[model samples]
Target: MIQQPFFTPAILLVLFAIPLALGWVPRNRFYGIRTRRALADDAAWYRINRSGAWCLIVSGLFYLAVAWVVPMSGPQDVNFRLWLLHLFAFVLPLLLGLVRIRHLSRQD
Candidate 1:
C-alpha cells in the first residue's frame, strides 16, 4: 500500500520553492511564475518569483501541518475533502502571487 502521499507532495513543493526562493531558478517559461512583466524584467522576475516562491513554501508547510494535525482515517469523503483542502492550499499561492505581483510591480 502507498504510504503518506501528502508528505511526499508537501516535501516536494517545499524543495522546489526553496531553490526558486533563493533565486536559483533562472527565469524561464518552463518553470517559476511566468508572468509577462516578470519574465520581461530582470528585477521583477526575482522579486515576483521570490515572493511567489515564499507563498508556495508557506502553502506546502501549511498542508504538512494540517495533514499532521488531522489524524483522519475515517470516511472516504473526509479523505476526499482533505485532498480538496490540500488542492486549495496548493493553488491559492498562484492566485495570491498574481495579486501580489500587481502590487509589487507598482512598488518598483
Candidate 2:
C-alpha cells in the first residue's frame, strides 16, 4: 500500500464540507459556493451549497478509494493513469456542483 499525499486534499474537502452540508456554516464570503447563482438568495444558497457538499463528499470518497487501491511509492511514482483518475475525482464533483447550482439558480 502506498500513501498518496494528493489524496489528503480530497479527505480535507470532505471534512470541510460536513459543516456546510449540515447547514452549520452559513452563507458567507469565506466559505461555501459564493457564486452569483448560489448567493442570489437564501434558498439558492442552501440548495446549491447542499448539492455542492454532497458532490465534494462523494468525490472525496472516490479519491480516497482510488488512492488506496492504486500502487505508488511516492508523488514521483504517480503515472499518467493515476493522475487522470485523481483529476477526475476532483473535477467531476466540481462540474456536477456547477451544474446543480445552475439548475437551482434557474429555479429562482
Candidate 3:
C-alpha cells in the first residue's frame, strides 16, 4: 500500500493564522518595518487598522469556506459551491479594501 501524505488542514489553516496573529500586535512591532518608509506618519495607524480588519474578515471567510468545500468526498460534486465561495472570497474583500483605503486616504 502506498502511504499517502497526511492532509492536515490545520497546517493549511495556520497559513491563515500566522499573518493575522502578527498583524494584531503593536503596529511598529509586527509591521512597522514595512510601513516605516512608505506610509505617511499620520496614515500609518490607519493603514494598519484597515489592513488588520481586512485580514481578519478575509481569513475567517477563507477558513470557513475551505472547511465546507474540502470534505465533499461523497456522491455529490461541490465544485460549483467551491467556485461561488472563491468568487465571493476574491471580490468582496477587494471591494471593501478599496473603499476602506479611500476613506483612510481621505483622512490625511
Candidate 4:
C-alpha cells in the first residue's frame, strides 16, 4: 500500500489562514489579497482577506472530508488519484474565493 500524506493540504491551508483570519496581517504587497481595490482601501483589505481566509478554512475542511471518505487504490492508480484530489481540494475553493473577492472589492 502506498503511504499517503493526506492531511498536508488541510494543515497548510489552515496555517495560511490564521493570520488573515485574525486580521493580523496588514495591507501589503507581500501577503493577503493584494488586488488593486483591496490594497487601496483599509476596510476592503480586512474584509476581503477575512473572506478569503474563510475560504481557506472551508477548503481545509473539505480536504479532511476527502481524506476520510476517499478510498485508496492500488499503486497504479495512486498518482492519478492524488492529482485529482489536489485539483479538487485546491482549485474549487480558490476559484470561489476569487470570485467572492472580485465582487466584494468591486462593491465599494
Candidate 5:
C-alpha cells in the first residue's frame, strides 16, 4: 500500500468531495468529450454518469481507509490485496463511463 502519513486523511477528504465535484462540474466538461446533439439529453446523461463516477471514487477511498485502519492479524499480503480492492472501486466508474458513452452514441 502507498503509505503516506498525511495522505490518508487528505485523500479521504478529496474522495468525499468526488460526489460534489461530479455534481458541480457539467457532464460534458467532466466527461472530457463533447456531443453534438440535444442539450438536455447530454446533460442528463452526464449527470447520471458523473454521479456513478463519484460513487466509485468515494467507495474506493472508503475501502482504502478500511484496509489501513483495520489491523487484521493476517499476513503482509492482505495489505496489497486491500489496495487492489481500492483500485477496483475507482476503476468501476470509468468502465461505467465507457458504457454511458456507447449508449449515447447509439442514439439517432
Candidate 6:
C-alpha cells in the first residue's frame, strides 16, 4: 500500500477547489461560499468562489512544494515543521482569498 503523506491538506484542497474553480460545482450552502456577499447571488457566488478556489489551489501547491523542499529528520522535529507548514497551508490561502474577495467585491 502506498503510504499517504501525513500532510495532505494542500493536496486535498487543490483537488477539491479545482472543480469549483472550473465551475463544475454549483453554488451551495454546503460547499461554496456562505458569506453574505457571495451568497447574495449566483453570479457573485461563482465569481468569488472561482477566485477563492484559485487562491486555495495556489496556496496548496505552495505548501506542498515547501514541505517537499524542507527535509525533516526525526519524529519530534518533523512534527514541529509539519505543524508550521500546515499553519502556512491554511493561512496563506485564507489571506489570498480575502485579497481576492476584496478585489472581486470592488468590481461589483
**What lDDT score belongs to each candidate, Candidate 1 first?**
0.71, 0.74, 0.46, 0.74, 0.50, 0.70
For model 3, the run of ten residues with the poorest summed lDDT = 1-10
Off by over 4 Å in 1: 74-108
Candidate 4, residues 1-108: lDDT per residue as tens digits?
123344665677788888998999999999887788889989989998898888777877776666566745534455785758755765687677778767877886
TM-score of each: 0.69, 0.76, 0.39, 0.75, 0.38, 0.72
Cα distance off (Å), candidate 1, residue 103: 5.2
lDDT, candidate 2, at 3: 64
Root mean square deviation (Cα) for candidate 3: 7.1
Model 6, residue 12: what's the lDDT? 81
**Whole-model lDDT for model 1 versus the true structure?**
0.71
Sort by TM-score, best first: 2, 4, 6, 1, 3, 5
Candidate closer to the true structure by TM-score (higher is better), 2 or 3: 2
What are the per-residue Cα lDDT tens digits for candidate 1 across 1-108? 013346677688789889889998887998887777878888888988798788778877876766666534534445776667656655675467557657765664
Candidate 2 per-residue lDDT, tens place, 1-108, comes to 336755668778889988888888777889997888666677778887887788778878776777677645676765878777767766786677668766766775
Question: Candidate 3 on 24-69: residue-level lDDT in tens?
Answer: 4344545432344225453465455546455545554554555455
Per-residue alpha-carbon lDDT of model 5 for 1-108, expressed as tens digits?
455332354366456547544665454444433444323575655554454445545555654565467433444445665545545544554466556655554566
**What's the lDDT for residue 37 in model 1?**
80
Clashes of 2: 0
Report the Cα lDDT for candidate 2: 0.74
